[model samples]
Target: MHHTIEVEDLYFTYPDGREALRGVNLTVPPGVKMTLVGPNGAGKSTLMLHLNGILRGEGRVRVAGMEMNEENLPRIRAAVGMVFQNPDDQLFSLTVFDDVAFGPLHMGLPEADVLLRVETALRAVGMSEYRNRVSHHLSMGEKKRIAIATVLSMHPEILVLDEPSAGLDPRARRMLINLLKGLDMTMLISSHDMPLVAELAEQTAIMDNGQVVACGPTAQLLADHALLERHGLAP
Candidate 1:
């Protein structure tokens, strides 16, 4: 079985002495969409950081069969795309075109190819019309979409996202959902929105206290009212 992402007995601790992850074991198969549901301090973000070598942790971590180490970090980052919780954190360029094209441009691709990638990614996220608009002038929802496009332009195999629908209005939310539906790649999403999770993920993992308590089919996990209540996923 080939896994796009793999981890074995992973452990991570913050400099402030907070143990963010405790022996996390996870595997994301190629082309699978898995949502991670957990409380604020459950270490979901920490785990995601480990995927592309943003934060090196103890034990084994692998992406697309390559171990997560200094030597493999660059290739791992190219294979994995991460969209942060805040669009502002990810989008710093003056224009949408620049932000979306940043990754490909930095990779030494020809200018024509970089432009093509930027256009394709913008179209994929339904942001092609705003390609020349200033990033700071866009609405929250628009910024989010562009942030996604910026990463998508890299043509990564694994897409990791955190709170993708944080500030989207109803219409924008629907658009984002539809956009996600059209994507045919392995996705690791972390969000508090249960409805979105139901629509996007085929599988789900429940994490708490720095560990994954359970993982299985999305419907089965979400249907467990008692389990959800215990973990604060339900009220």
Candidate 2:
């Protein structure tokens, strides 16, 4: 079977000698949606970094059948689109349109194609009207949408998101959920939002101290309060 992402015996550590991941082995099939639910220090963000070769770790890590290395960095990055926790960090251009068009331009696409991709990506996230607006002037929700569009312009096959729902009100959260649901890419979302996981993911993995403690169907994991509590996902 073809897998979109593969992680085997992966290990990562910070510069300060803090171990982040310990022997993590994970495989994500093409087009599958998975959620990673873990505590603040469980290394969810660290693991996401490895998906696109941002932070290399020990052992094998692959995306879209390509191994993570300097040889495959460009291809791997084009295949894995990561939406960071903060939109401000992702969208840095002066105008929203420029921010969304940056990725395609960096990939060396033609002017016409780059503009077309920018327009399509913004429309996909329902933010086409704000294309000319300044990135710094947009609200949190709008910024988040533009961030997604920025990556979407690259036409990534795997979409990795970290805390996509953080700091959003109920309405904006729902809107973001709807936007995600409409996409057709393989999604790997790391969030603490139980309801969002239950609504979107078929599989869920709970991690602690950089290790996966439990992984199974989303419904099964959510149904077990004991397991949830063990992972600090429950009150």
Candidate 3:
């Protein structure tokens, strides 16, 4: 079976000689919603950066059947939609419509097609009513949804998120969780929120010291208290 995302023997290091990923390997099958959980400095974010060619590292990273390379970056980025932990990082346009339309516009799509994509994406995130509103004025929950809408307009095959539940309150977190549950694309989310992981992921991979230490069904992994405790996921 073909994988939607594949990382094999990945290795990455910062300029200061700090290793962020070491021989990491992971795979996400098509249409799978998987979560990567681990303590701080586990290289989850580092690994995510490689998904869209934001941070080139030593290893074979493939997404939607395309290998990571300078020549393939444009196509690869179009295939993988990355949602950062901070919604602010993703939304910059004055209006929610423009923010969501940026990707399709850049793709040189027709005006009608761009409008359609923007509308479809906003509807998908349940933010269609806020299309004309200022992106920066919305609440955190609203912003998160809009951020996702911006990515959805690109029509990516894979959705990669980093710490999606990071600063959200309970209500916003719940909303975010529901929003994620409704997305049908392949997803690889890096989050510390175990409950969110349990709710959204069918599969889970535990990362530590820059490597994937374990991978299995969410229920099986979450049931392992000793493993969770050892990895600082549970007390």
Candidate 4:
């Protein structure tokens, strides 16, 4: 019964002396899709950054049975794939194929293996036809899918997404939701989209003022309108 992720009394502060995370504690079991919901500045992104050692704070953070530290960073990062809110931030290569192949290539995988990973990842995201296309020229939705494929090519066991559905149109959002539902890895998604959260996550954790304030079943938490309103999730 090993947990996929664990955080204990995590605390972090920015260089400017602003505290981003305040003694946060969280745990995600393997194969669970959990949504992290909170008002702006609640430290959701900050917390997600710690999952793979992007932001090392004062606390214990573990992923895939490895502790968060400089020595374990490479392994931890390989195990935890992070997809940022903006697809542009994740996509930098010339073509979609290059962008998706970047991680596997960096891992020093063989040429054939990298090619296979790129193809498999693109097919998973329904972007196989866009492999040769320019990454910057695609639509937001297409770019988002490619961004996800970039991480998928790494063969991560856990997926951490930050505001994945932001700026998506109805159709794009729906498509993203479907794509996420199809991914079998453990996921911790940070988003304000309640409906998307409801559709994808079985468990939900609400963050506020740099800490997790509530956590429970998605249906149970979403049903508490007063709690949602208090956290700025509902009007």
Alpha-carbon deviation at 23 in model 4, angstroms: 0.9
* Model 3 alpha-carbon drift over 4 Å, by segment: none
lDDT of 3 by residue, 75-161 (tens): 999999999988999999999999999989999999999999999999898888999999999998899889999999999999999
Clash numbers, per candidate: 0, 0, 0, 0
lDDT of 4: 0.93
- Candidate 1 lDDT by residue in tens digits, 1-235: 5799888888999999999999998888889999999899999999999998889889899898898888988999999999998999999999999999999999999999999999999999988899889999999889989999999999999899998888889988898889888999999999998999999999998889888888999999999999998888972
Q: How many collisions between residues are there in candidate 2?
A: 0
Question: What digit string (tens of lDDT, one per residue) describes model 4 on residues 121-185?
Answer: 99999999999999999999999999999999999999999999999999999999999999888
Which residue pairs show collisions in model 1?
none
Poorest stretch of ten by lDDT in candidate 2: 226-235
